[model samples]
Target: MTPVVSLRGVRVAHQGRTVVHAVDLDIQRGSWFGLVGANGSGKTSLLKALAGRLPFSGGACLIGGEDMIADRAGRAEQFGFAPPADRLPDSLRASEMLAFVGGHLDRVRRNLGPLRQALGVDPLLDQWIGNCSAGMKQRLAIAAAFAGGQKLVILDEPFNWLDPVAIFDLRLALRQMVDDGLTLITALHDLHALVVACDDGLILANGKKRIDLSHGMLRDAAVAPSLFEKEMIDILRAGAAE
Candidate 1:
């Protein structure tokens, strides 16, 4: 089967500084994939590039085998992207923000009830975005992303302000979403969470691929936490030294 998402020699530069270098990646359909790296290592940049939010300087990215660069709108329609909470607008109410998301595709509006319940966002609908806490906003953003029922979801630093309980719920929700046949790619800081939630992991160091481990290669749940953390820390340390 063709990969749900594919990047070939993808690169991204910001203000003349290349942050992501020639990355080739393939994410299988319905798989949960984690992009792990230290701050500034280009995990977020790569995710944005894959989501077609940023134009790559070279190579190509395809969503469901369609060239993203050539069909920006069509490519965007295939995935729901939620940036970090701080990037979301502060002026809108939760309802307004959700409406904006629904405007993009009718599926979002149609699925509003179930998504709101799943994210525990029903009570937050009337709150002003600026007044909501970080965790609340994160939840709302996540809910809005899935509102559209897009086949692929891309989230950048989703755990930034989530409380412990929210984190726990999010893990279960994400796993359930994947089981329901949607592909997920998230940039996350927690190695343990990644191992628990994702079937595969990709490590980036100084904007380049350092490790790509599939589900079959990862250790069992019992040993994964320690082993994954050690490997990630070693890569970060090596990147810092370079």
Candidate 2:
């Protein structure tokens, strides 16, 4: 079967500075992939490129066998992209927010009750999202992303404002989605979350991917964490140089 997403020789630059260079990646259908990195490691850029939100220098990114360069919108709409775009209506209730998401794709399933509980947004669903806490906002964002029921979901720093329990619930929803055949790619900060949620790991640093490790290796006592930290520093220093 064709991969849910594929990228080869992908490069992204900004203001004459190369951010991501020659990245080749493949995300299998129904797999949950993790991206681990420090700031400026090109994690967000790479995710955006894969989501077809950024133009790349030289490469092909195929989404569900459709080339993004050739048909960007059609391909992009097939995947759920919850960018940190602040695109939500602040005054809307959580239920109203999900209603908007449902309306976007003409979905009749306005039953956000279950998902709200699953994502732990039940208590805050009727309140204005703008007045909610940061974790609540994060949960709302995630709810919208999954609301559309797209085949692929790409999330960047999705754990930014989430509390520990909310984070775990999000992990549960994500894992359930993968098991149900939706491709997932996420950038997260907590190591414990990553350990529980992902199988294979991709480590990015200095605008490039430095390591791809098995779940066992990532959980190793003297292996994955050490190497990942080193790569993260490399990325941080590289950013400082620039």
Candidate 3:
């Protein structure tokens, strides 16, 4: 089967400075792929470029066989992106925000009921976004990402501001979604969560691909998590020193 997401020599730049170097990747349908990197390692920039929210150069980025940059409107329907909580609109009610972004509030609510319940965002739906706490906002942001019933969802630092219980719930929920045929891409800082949730992942260091963690490797890491984490830390530290 063709990959759900494919990138070849992908590069992203900001202010004429390239932050994401030439990179190649492929993610199969129904897989949960993780992006791991330290601060300023280009994870966010790469995610934005893939989602068509940022401009990129040097190669092709195809989502479901279509050019992501050229067919952004179609891509929006295929994937949902939940950026940082601070990017949500403060003035709108959570429900309104979902409707604005996802279109058709009723359909969004019906399609994303499970995710909303899992995220504990139902109570905040009627509340203005400005009044919600960081955790609450984060929950809403996650729910909003799935509001469109997208086949793929990309989350950046989704564990931020979430309590331990919420984190656990989200992990379970995301796993279930993938099992039910959702393609997930997440930029994560929490290695524990990455080991627990992701089937495949790669480490990014200084705008370059540092390590690719395959499914079998991650499965082994799941059994011996600390060893995996140590390996990642050693790599990251080495990358940082360079």
Candidate 4:
């Protein structure tokens, strides 16, 4: 079967400086994929490119067999994204913001019931986004992302500001989504969560693709957190040395 998402020789640049080098990748259908990288390693850049927020300077991005850049509406219909916490609008109420971000998509409206139930957003609906606590904001953001019943969901730094209980709840929610055939991708620093949740993961260092770990490799790392942390650190170190 064709991959759900594909990147070929992709390159991204900002302000005349290249941030993501030529990179190639494929994300399978119905799988939870993880993107890992140190600060400024181009993880967000790649996600933005995939989300159509940023234009790619070279190569191609395909979503569900359609060229992502060339087929804007198709790409938009196929994926939903949750940006970082700091990027959410503070001016609107939680309900207003969620509506503003996802209201146009029919899938979002159709899928909102499950998201509302899972993220527990009813209490925060009337609250102004700026007034809500950090955890509240994060929960709303998550609700907004999963609200779209797109084939693929991309989330950046999803666990930020979440308490232990919220984190546990979110993980269960993600697992349920995957079980229901949603393709999930996230760029996160929570190594333990990544290992526990993702079937596959890629590590980026200095805008370069450094390592791709399969399910067994990721599961193995979970046996010892330090081992996985050390491996990520080593990848970054290697990139820095180059």
Reference-based TM-score of each model: 0.91, 0.82, 0.95, 0.90
Model 4 compared with the native: what TM-score? 0.90
Q: Would you list the clashing residue pairs of candidate 2?
A: none
Clashing pairs in 4: none
CA lDDT for candidate 3:
0.86
Q: Whose TM-score is greatest here? A: 3
lDDT of 1 by residue, 1-242 (tens): 79878888888888899998888888999899989888899998887766667767887888778777555566667778885676678898887887788764344545543445556776887899999988888888787777666778888877777788777777777787788887889998888777778888788889998878688755564376787577679988898578
| Best-performing candidate as measured by lDDT | 3
lDDT of 3 by residue, 1-242 (tens): 89999988889999999999998888989999999999999999998878778877778888878776555556556778885798788889998998887787888777675686778767887999998999999998888888877888999998899989888888888898899899999999989888889989989999998888899999999899998889999999888777
User: Residue 233 error for model 2, in Å?
Assistant: 6.7
Superposed Cα RMSD, model 2: 3.4
lDDT of each: 0.78, 0.71, 0.86, 0.81
Candidate 2 lDDT over 1-242, as tens digits, reads 67777887788887788899888777788888888777778988887766667767677877767667545566567767774636567878877877777674235133332455766755766788778776677777877777777878888888787777776776776787688777888886655556667766677777887766565765672356656556555654665465
- Local distance difference test, candidate 1: 0.78
Off by over 4 Å in 2: 85-87, 104-115, 219-242
Better of 3 and 4 by lDDT: 3
